[model samples]
Target chain A: MHELSIVFHIIKTIEQVGEENKLEHVNSVTLEVGEVSAVIDEYLGDCWKWAADRSELLKGARLVIEKLPAVTMCETCERTYATVQYGRICPYCGSERTYLLSGREINIKEIEVG
Target chain B: MQNNSIDVICAAAGSGRMEHFMKEVKILEIKKSVFEDNDREADALRGELHEKGIFLLNLMSSPGSGKTTTLLRTIEALKDRLKIAVMEADIDSDVDAHAIAGAGVKAIQLHTGGMCHLDAGMTRQGLEGLEAAEADLVVLENVGNLVCPAEFDTGAVKNAMILSVPEGHDKPLKYPLMFEVCDVVLINKIDVLPYFDFDLEKCREYVRMRNPEAEIIPICAKTGEGIDAWADWILREVAAWKADK
Candidate 1:
């Protein structure tokens, strides 16, 4: 699955951060996953566990995932609504002039080192 | 660093006394997007392709949605008029590449090794293999997936998606992200429109609801209907894309 590739990418990033920070070992990694993002959190965790364990800097590191809500901005109404509840049309003005504001993110929010 | 070492030593020495040792947990806020690296790479690739005046189109669709057929039709329409090449991506097998090659143009097969989607790096690799700089138009026929490919920008100048008539008109409702990111939506397989209960107007409405600016084109890839319009749209887009650069 692509989750493995993403896991590898994360590990590579974390390793670079570790090198720059002179981090001997990482305790945990926190990631913010958006509701509309294609990545599956459970699969990501599984992939991370499998890959992170092999890396010396990330050995036994716990992966934490925080879900971010999907939001959409209505251009016609100048208001925002939960994208998960409403597809694309603005619920307030019944307008199709809406764009996704956020929730497609897959951000590495924080890193805990020991 | 010295203070941490002393604290660790104290904690080990005062193992029996919990109150004697105080440890502080340190956390660094990264606040960095996981897609940051990919996005940066995609932007760089886009710049490189733009410098070469190559208009890259990322074509996505579900499996069996006539992506190859539509590509074949597109090649037939535009190959003689302009230089065209294809980077066909699939989980495995080069059947699509062979088909494109049969159409009498350069075709490079990208086997993802079971990856459902092609990332920016993968696309760059495919472009390198396809020798895209020599061609005026390079079409990246991404892996036949509606979900994963929608999330990744493949450094394409324009993103186009095909929704076949047999797939029903309600697909945008289920897969909103795919329709939302598309610059153009191609409604393919109109020749079989009479047999299926698929409504063209409803499909267009759904696409419009998700993406108001997306150009919707209905065509039958098998019969070559509405291909000239598609080719003209491409020509205009290519000119606009190059001119803007």
Candidate 2:
């Protein structure tokens, strides 16, 4: 449901970049989505195909996605661990004084123009 | 450049052949988070709200979690002491907004059209619609969804969530991110403790395991069991917010 809104945001950003670079056509876009971002790539792709086809610059544009691992930092032991594996608790020290360091991102990494 | 070298080699070994082999292609590096714009807007809104001395509390919970009932009860408790307003966000109707207005406080409904969550920009617009500048407290009753609402910040001074006893005590394990970001977690519907097998202590432990700093308050809005404690928490938060200003 929210994927369409996200696609619109992505298209607006690419259009701004295109305008700044004086480009006419966008061939593809590369996105770096975190493992824990809760944004499903399949839905994003479907939404992109529906929305991007309507834009003049993004017609037939390809969408590529890259995944980033989620990591958590333990303040007690000052160690980093996989968030998906152990959640909020630190595996090394059994400490709940931990916070997420990464893996909640939805980034546009690159844009290819032809 | 590599293509140009390949073209040069092709020309050297060619048997009298000419072709158009050069094409202009640009690979622009745009390493930007899709949420960067929203996060920046949230920070700016936070700064603006802080300057205006308005304590914004973002309330989130799952559907049928008695968020409206809790809000009404809260208003009855704190309306005499503080000026409160509500911005109710929903995907479709204004039912919650109407309920809030019936409570005799300023209320505004934000129709997200179809969006599942409320972003900072949407919250700012809602605040403007409610004329929240004059109110001492603005409660943004965010759209009822545990997963999506926790993903976005709406420039609120504090984030609070409600979990009813019927919703099960294992909510923290299922929705860890929500518990992780909340400053306070209100375990509501404790009056039904005898009916359901909801373990209050186990629930508290689950919430604490995810967020050690979060304050868990047990309440039954239907009977006003823990309304005083909840109201006190709000007053303390409002005072601390003012002190920071």
Candidate 3:
């Protein structure tokens, strides 16, 4: 699954950060995932638990996720609306000239170490 | 050593877990994109390709969308003018690679070991395996999937996808990211358009709604119709990529 690859990327990034900061152990990691980023949180958590336990520094580390809502901007109306509520078509203007403003983000916000 | 000595003293003084209580936990603010590493790797690979004067095209599409057939046609059209190579990525099997090699070009197969997509690192490895420096154009036939491949950049100079007539025109709306990332959309199997009730204009409109800048080329890889236009697009892209530097 793509979530496994994402977990691998997270581990790799965390390992790089650990080396740079000389971290002995990671306590937790917080992620900022957009609402429509296509990443399933449960699958990500499952993949993280399986993969993190294999890394000595990240063993037993907790995974925290913070969701960012999806927003779309209508070019015709110049108004922003919830992407999930009203998809490609603008609800206000009934126009197809709309683009996503946000909601596809998958970022690592922070990490806790002890 | 100081903390260890304090812990020993605390233990000797019968202070229950004073050292553990005194240990400080710190939060490191690393506001980084999850794809930051991959994106950096992809950019570096692009720079390397540019210096080598090589054009890498990342081709993506669904299974049975005629990627291999279209690639064969493309090679037949451009093989005489340009040195072309291919890296076929799949979860298993070397069938695509074999087909490409049979076409009298350098071809290598990359097995992703069940991964659905190829990242920048995997692409570099494939390029190395193919000894791609000898070739002017190296096409990475990415795993035949629309979703995961769009999320990962394969370090290619350009990205293209094949949407067959049977797949419906709403694919751009369904897989918006795939269409948005592609530089060109090849609408293949146009020979059967009359039988399929596939409206080319409607498809173009949908793709434009997703990506206004994408160039759509309608072709039938089987009949070799409109292949010259596709070949022309490649020729122009390769020339532009080489000339820019």
Best by TM-score: 3
**What digit string (tens of lDDT, one per residue) describes model 2 on residues B1-245?**
12453231111112112223336655666777776667778899989988988999999999999899999999999999999999999999999999999999999999999888898989999998888778889999999899888878888989999999999999997888899989999999999999998999999988987888999999999999998999999999988887898
- Residue B128 lDDT (model 1): 88
Compute each candidate's TM-score over C-alphas: 0.88, 0.86, 0.93
Candidate 2 Cα deviation (angstroms), residue B207:
1.4
Model 1 DockQ class? acceptable
Displacement of residue A63 (Cα, Å) in model 2 is 0.9
Over 4 Å off, model 2: A71-101, B1-23
Ranking by lDDT: 3, 2, 1
Docking class of 2: acceptable
Interface RMSD of candidate 2?
Answer: 9.7
Better of 2 and 3 by lDDT: 3
Better of 1 and 3 by DockQ: 3
Among these predictions, the greatest DockQ belongs to 3
Sort by DockQ, top down from the best: 3, 2, 1
In model 2, what is the error at residue A35, expressed in angstroms? 2.2
Q: Kindly list the per-residue Cα lDDT of model 3 for residues B67-88, writing each as its tens digit.
A: 9999999999999999999999
lDDT of each: 0.85, 0.86, 0.90
